[model samples]
Target: MVGLVLEDWASPSRATASGGEYGVLMYCAKIASRAGHTQRIFVAEFRPDSDTQFVSVGIKHVRFWTLAGRALLSKKGVLSSIEEARMQTMLSVAFGANNLTFTGTISGDVCVWKEHVLVRIVAKAHTGPVFTMYTTLRDGLIVTGGKERPSKEGGALKLWDQELKRCRAFRLETGQVIDCVRSVCRGKGKILVGTRNAEIIEVGEKNAACNILVNGHMDGPIWGVGAHPTRDVFLSAAEDGTVRLWDIPEKKMLNKVNLGHPARTVSYSPEGDMVAIGMKNGEFIILLVTSLKIWGKKRDRRSAIHDIRFSPDSRYLAVGSSENAVDFYDLTLGPALNRINCCRDVPSFVMQMDFSADSCFVQLSTGAYKRLVYEVPSGKQVTEQAVIDRITWATWTSVLGDEVVGIWSRNADKADVTCACVSHSGLNIVTGDDFGMVKLFDFPCPEKFAKHKRFLGHSAHLTNIRFTSGDRYVISAGGDDRSLFVWRCIHAPH
Candidate 1:
């Protein structure tokens, strides 16, 4: 771990923290700004094994600064303001409806938010911390699942109806608490559940009533599970240090790969032609589905790879590691070619990372909680230095543009951070935070929309954020309020 504790800064300063995302070790340097803003710079290290020496991965000394402040956008170097809020502990986001959802604990209850507005939807939802939530393909229905029950017993899963504002469907009696939950289109009607006991259960609707049960090896908890988009096939990873491929319809294990390290996260390439796995021991491997051959000789690094994604064009694989840098490899060339270290003067862990649909740029969340952009091909910083903290998660908006949009920190006139999102198109943005305040930002010109204005309200800290498909709504989840909120994006007018 490589981070610094800021003892001499302002009231709300930053602390640098570092760890392995899977196997890589990233170092972050965090610093505070005049307006109580924070920035981070990330450096990455990679290696083949414990005995071998570490390689630089070609990402040393590069710097990234905040793009949200006045210094970066001064008349000499002008940009735009898109929204409000400083930072968020965002939880979950879903596609299709152009929605983003967040989850967090507030007074022991679960809260949800949409578009910076409080949804007025409330529920006791869980006895303990709510771990994950999902929105189904069916309109207006959401699913939330948690592991620890109120009684400290087996956990439960609940289904809710957004329009009706009630608990519509739920399963309360699974013997073991759920380790992970996945929602995928399996034929006409089945939901797949993976439990802590290394078992897979398929819950189907009446029309597709085929309750499939699958059994597999290693007594450890399951780490991750995912299903194919067009097919019913699914894949699972476990702490027992194994990855299993299952065919849902047959309810049988298709193949197994014994990765040397305990698997942390797994992802299928967008084309479904390959699978990428991040391990606990600071290594990442790419495997061909057909031959199951491990690709590129088992690339090992010093830090863990927390997030793995294939670019939209499927030509490059972007990896977000415990180190502050984001690395990319050409699918055709088979090794990392480019890397983005933490911002200049800002050294911190990368809390989250995402690539735009066109793969031209990347979004980064620093350990200090600040968010910024890096032009892809050139690996250049887009914004000025700004500060944020405790940034848990972030995702790219689905709207089309050469520009990137997502939630970020909004300090306004204070030193605290709030949650906000920016739209590169309208140059407009919105934000909300722990104070339950939501604001809209408009620029003097559509080209300069990165500024601020308070617009809505919430009762607690902002947990998750995402924009709707129509670009007209933003969804947020998880707060002290224990409710879901959806805000309609009001155009500022031409």
Candidate 2:
């Protein structure tokens, strides 16, 4: 086994109660392989009297070193880059089964990563921040839309081929901010674009000709658009507190349902039989597709509903809110809309969520650090010490306080889990942290300090982490780090 050392130095002005300067430092050591172990060490210096903390790191075989905190690689791990300006924020991400990942950034660049490494950077792909992105049915084709800048025509739609090369650009004459875009038609040759001006623009990918299909929302901006699975119809949710269903072939509005609240997002069930709408007032509603009759509706009252998605099987609807909670509703429960589970008190605003492919679990991401996973139908939290802590409380209370006071375990470390996801099999989970560490934990982590594997390459807070379809690898990105890292996983016994 190789040994790792850590050192800390404190300034003389920051003396402790004992009249001496004090500091805290931690070190971890792991076997590199079966032989020729590699040693990695890091030293952090803290001064209570100063506003800054300094860290230095070194790694043996990789020959990695860092001075101060600005160097690319530190003793922690190798820093990956796309040879472009540091990304401001990761606005959108898309994955391909071919091991290709595409990310859009606030810097107006679209980066493509293969096997978790940055392979291509489409620099300045837009005039302003890339707000939305979509991947076509064809493997390599991607569509990106951005906000308008002061001097340049913004809200333009651009298409790129597989090599991160721009193939076509379509400029929207409406000058409205494009909020969302989707591929329409069976061949994926046409695009559907939604704008804040309450317009749904349908344009051809080859000709780039814009045709206004609907401009009916008179009240407010349109936030979401959903295409029907089998029909030439689509649904649009607007801040006007209504959902409009339009017939593409007829070039007219077929129906409009007043949801009574500003709708932020709408999603059609996989079978196209139901539509779920999320409102700005935290009201979630479900309606039958054909009749446009309300099937069920519920209000959370805590915060606005930001997103809603249906499980792959259309068995459940997951609602995410700004209040840091995710509610799972079993669609088969009818008028009761029977909420099977509620994951509440997440560290920050719930920004995104997705159900496992098997519909066994739901994964959620927050605005801050940390991700959470919970079991479907059961509502049991499978991440952190939530479930186990409850059990421990019950067991400990059953015994007399004096009998177990001396034998209790130490407190678990506090972590602001920002974003998390469970594997398809529901066997493993990966989470990103505010400190830029991506950790792998066993499902339903029974203990606060459960056995976990850590991957440390990012030097900034991690914004997103996800497992590949087969659960063979994990892809992580840090907005501050401006890079993506992929790690291979060694299966553990369930």
Candidate 3:
């Protein structure tokens, strides 16, 4: 059991700044000099033995350093910095057993990367900051939605061919900057796109038409959306403190739940029998998918929950928030798995989080100046380093087909990257940044794990990353630059 410690990151820093508010403010002003300064990544990890540690990445090339005062491996390069204004968001998807597809925002352009090569495969896909993008399970294509330049006109939604070289090969215009895009199962050959203005559009190969203009959320905008994995049911959480379940085939609202707090994130159980929601009040609510019955609720209202995810088995729910900890609870049983704080090492204000398929571990992306990782079943810290930027979990794979951890990084102490995503195999992770470049990271299998791979590519601030159902490809959505990039997994090490 892990203890939970919640704190506000923006609180008065006077007490910690050695002086008063003015002193702290002055300190921040001085450090602002380093705000845009560039930095590169250096890697150090514990071996399977946990005794012999290795360090790599140096000034000229990757080389090796010491564990107990002995050199192992170390590598280095002068990675250029993407301008602050171009960084937007990053998203990722798993395409193969060992590859990730990446998309990120860079000042109105979207770019895609294959691995961590610090180069772009597809560039300049959108005209504004790409806020979100997603991929359909049926095919390898990607759909992206983002804000357009001038800010006056809303963004548009466009479709892309993942195999292409430059941005989206064939883009279907939605005529508006869509905050989010959800692909709902539409029977024969169609998908649905939900927009910022609450409009649902039906898109297919031949025709794309406006389906429904949802007149919900009078007080605020829609922030999150998800579809039931098994049924035609969809869930949407809004700033209005409500979660609505819509029956896609029926085109009707099934159940509208007033969670009594601003809903920031929502997810369906893998079985599609329940919906898990994270609220602004720092609580989580579970609703029966079919009956709309409230089965359980967990309230901690001290910090805002930024994301929530259910274990693949639907037995546990993981909550990520502005607080420095991640809380877990057994949904099949009772009493949430006592919240786990990453001690002082874990940063605060997480932006997003994901659980492996087996729910054995959790990867959290933080706004707290660093990222953290935790073992799920036991709620223990697995890594000793603080991530200086955003990260995402793609998947889990093992020799027994058990739990394997997959992750990707963005804003890696260098650029102002925003979002990111991963696949299911735990073999590949993709990232994007402000430079409008996408990069890929591959995890090689240890003799103990059965497989492994290295990562490459990308040159911008990545905003978003998402993996497909089969975990064979990744779709990336960029921010600052309106662009959408897709990368297929070139290899799957099974």
Scored by lDDT, the top model is: 2
- Please give, for residues 184-269, the per-residue lDDT of candidate 2 as tens digits: 22135788775554456788767767776655564644555555655656677776787877554454667778777788777778
Give a tens-digit lDDT track for model 1, residues 1-494.
01111121111112221121122357986432332122332211111122221111011111112334233211111112323321222222221233323232321134433433333324455554344455554564555555444343323445556542545334533453354433222333555555444445666544323343644544443444434434656566666688877653353667778886777556677678888887766677888888988764334457766556666677766666666666667676654433433233335555445666567666666665555676554556766434112221223321212232222233433223333444434445444555655545442123323444443334456433434443444444324542223444555445
Candidate 1 Cα misplacement greater than 4 A, ranges: 1-212, 216-229, 246-254, 297-300, 335-346, 384-494
Who is ahead in TM-score, 1 or 2?
1
- Candidate 3 Cα errors over 4 Å, as ranges: 1-221, 231-233, 246-255, 335-345, 384-416, 423-494
TM-score of each: 0.36, 0.36, 0.41
Worst 10 residues of 2 by lDDT: 392-401
Error of 2 at 377 (Å): 2.6
Tens-digit per-residue lDDT, 1-494, candidate 3: 11111111211111211111112233333211111113342222232223643223212232222344333332221223533323333432212112233343434455443333223434555565454555543555566665544233222555555553333222335453344443222335555555554445566645554444343453453445554554545566766788876554454566677777787777777877778888877877878776888878777657777777887767767777767667777665654434433223466666666676556767665665444567775667766443312323333211111121222222234234444433455545444445544434454322232222222222334445544444444434333222223344555245
Of 1 and 3, the candidate ahead on TM-score is 3
How does model 1 score by TM-score?
0.36
Ranking by TM-score: 3, 1, 2
lDDT of 3 at 424: 52
* TM-score, prediction 3: 0.41
Residue 17 in model 3: lDDT:
13
Q: Candidate 1: what lDDT? A: 0.45
